[model samples]
Target chain A: MDRFRVAAVVTLRRSIADVQGTTVEQALHALGFRAIENVRIGKYVEMEIRAASAEEAHRHAEQACQRLLANPVIEDYQILAVTPAVAKEVP
Target chain B: MKFGIVVFPGSNCDWDVYWAVRAGLGEEAEFLWHKEESIPGDIDCVVLPGGFSYGDYLRSGAIARFAPIMGAVARFARAGGLVLGICNGFQILCEAGLLPGAFLRNRQLRFVCRSVFVRVERSDTPFTNLLQPGAVLRLPVAHGEGNYYAEPSVLRELERRGQILFRYCDAAGQLTEDANPNGSVANIAGVLSPEGNVLGMMPHPERACETLLGGTDGLTVFESLQRHCTMAVATSAVL
Candidate 1:
């Protein structure tokens, strides 16, 4: 088994209003950065798992996103990146 | 009828609901820990109370929905047992897919804590049976993520099914933008499942049950549940 690190990104759907994101956008506008048009804030989750392969790790990560990490009602989720963790070199 | 109040780790309103059910309403009630894998078979009603369950981690009620006790709660609801979710509990219900919609941050980007008026949209459900249609109730709400949102189609279906139990309204019982404390769509404050057995609402009825607390309107909701349970038992006995 190889150790894999995975990150899940979750964000509210476009149709749903994001009050926090909008607040942040307004704050930025107050700072004179008016060029920002669409700024949406979301959640980023990271975890490590032992899996046989990267594909297996990705599958497990997706399942976690579906079951607990993200709510499908008003948000969408994606497995950002899955890579094998490298072991430290012996001194 | 026995009422079971599910107690998540961060749940602060479990005891409040217990007290309301036992001393206030003089009904049998007990606290069920979140780790428990089973609910008492004799429990006719289950309540998911308010508070930051799991500290509202990963969004409100997002983590609490995965608690072991929720499995039993889901089973109970499937069996047509009455289930009520208030405040954070309502978010948990939505996260668990027992109800539709998700709670977003308040439109004002602030945590609102105050008493608000809500109108009984439908008096036919077990939760609102004691209330008259269009009756206005003053209930206290405390939460940041109480802005309820859903797809247009789902909202239409909810309306068509008469599932909306309560809506925020003015003192005169008019639904207006000013009356919406959290900017909930259609000023919705509470909703019942299609079956009318499960209810989820942001208002804290348990907090409003005592006259000493300046409001006794909340008691009517519990009284309605009691009445419904008694009739249900009686009908089953005859069957």
Candidate 2:
């Protein structure tokens, strides 16, 4: 078995308005970064799972995104990465 | 009528609803813990009151939807029982797939806590049966994520089926932009399930039940439910 580190990103669908994102963009523009546009904010979630294979870990992470991490009606989620955890070196 | 109020981990309005039904309305009411697997058989109505359940983790109502009691709540709703979800409870119902649409952060990105007027769009549902057609009721809404949204097609269906029950409006019942406290689409404030047995709304009718609480306009909602239940019992007795 391997311990896999998984990272997921959840964002509101493009069709839905992101009030926080818009507010931040306005603040950025006020600070002189006028070129910034379409600033949408989202959530990043990271977790560790013990699975037999990287593929199994990815599947589990995807299921978690579907069932709990994101609401399909207004949000979308992506499994950013599924990599095996590294062991620490002994002192 | 007997009302079962589900108490989720962070539920703060359970007692409010319990008091509204028991002490205010003079009816039988009880609290059902989130961990309970089944609802008591004699319960005629079930209420999911407002509060930051599961601390609004991940998203409002996201984690609370999976509670053990929710399975029974879903079953109870499907079996044609009366179920009402208020405020955070509305979020939980949408997350649980018992209601359509999802909430977004209030368009202004602020938590709004104040009384607003909502015009009743339909008077046929169990929740609004006591109200006159096109009645405007003053209710208090307190929430940060009450901006209701849905796909365009779903929105059309909700309108076509007359499932929309309430809309934010002015004192004279005009759907003005200023009247919409949270920027909900089409100024919607509440809705009914396609089957018409379940209702979800972002406002807290429970909080407005007593005159001392500011107004008693909210009592009609509870009164309507009791009227519906009483009529049902009478009809069944004759049958």
Candidate 3:
């Protein structure tokens, strides 16, 4: 089986309520990170996918994230990477 | 005595814990926000309620472990105070290093909601004193990341110490894979700390506390704690 590492960076959907994000932005301002405004928080997920093709791996990762990782109603996400990047590459 | 339930964003079960502790245990349980700097004083027990804490982002309970209140929870638990975690709270306890193991997506890769049977493995812990070994209780569980994972040596230690509190069981109280909704190691559905005061279980005992809510099997859990506290009070009075 072909395998790929799917990493998802999920953030809140623009329309939904994210009380945590607002609180964080206020805290950052207090810390004097004024330039880092409008900070929205999300999660970075890295998992190995076993599939016959990279495309299938991407689809699997997408399903996993949508069904469990991110709630569809208030959250939206785009697949970040389904490729196994070099170990030294830092994103 | 006062008890506190830590609240997080998207925590759907904070009220459930409140009802269970207040009505079922008859204790004065209060709500604690995630941003709180310290726990309320003279707390007899601390509860970490289940829900999508940190919205279940960055793994089920990963980010919530870094919440401000958790630092206080850890300090209190380490000082021999009682701690209980349910579902996502269980995940957070593991993430916070108050308990061991990690909860992952169900191997079936679907959210599972069902009534499950759990066999009592030990009754020595304060949380399980009301039940006997091998007793079975039916409880409802609903979650996506319920699969529990831990390394071999640690699993062995938990086993040796009787820390494994509950195991998924068959209808006849036999441990079976079919009963384990998630692929938890050794079918472990709950666990306790070395001191027996800290408990983390995926099943929502609080949800089953009242017959009107469908079942009362959860009462034993809180009753066990109440009994222990009552005995302690009497002993102190005599002293």
What residue pairs clash in candidate 2, if any at all? Answer: none
Please give me the DockQ of candidate 3 compared with the native complex: 0.03
Model 2 interface DockQ: 0.88
Each prediction's DockQ?
0.78, 0.88, 0.03
| Candidate 3: regions farther than 4 A off | A1-91
> Which of 1 and 2 is the better model by lDDT?
2
Identify the candidate with maximal lDDT: 2
> Which 10 consecutive residues of model 3 chain B have the lowest summed lDDT?
B101-110
For model 2, residues A1-91, the per-residue Cα lDDT tens digits are: 8889999999999988898999999999999999999999999999998899999999999999998999999999999999889745689
Q: Which residues of candidate 1, in runs, are more than 4 Å off? A: A87-91, B237-239
Task: Sort all candidates by lDDT, best to worst.
Answer: 2, 1, 3
Query: In model 2, which regions exceed 4 Å deviation?
Result: A87-91
How high is the CA lDDT of each candidate model? Answer: 0.91, 0.94, 0.83
- In model 2, what is the error at residue B3, expressed in angstroms? 0.4
Ten-residue segment with the worst summed lDDT in candidate 1 chain A? A81-90
Local accuracy of candidate 2 as per-residue lDDT tens digits, B125-182: 8999999878999999999999999899999999999989999999999999999999
Q: What is the TM-score of chain A, computed separately for every candidate?
A: 0.89, 0.90, 0.78
CA-RMSD of model 2: 1.7
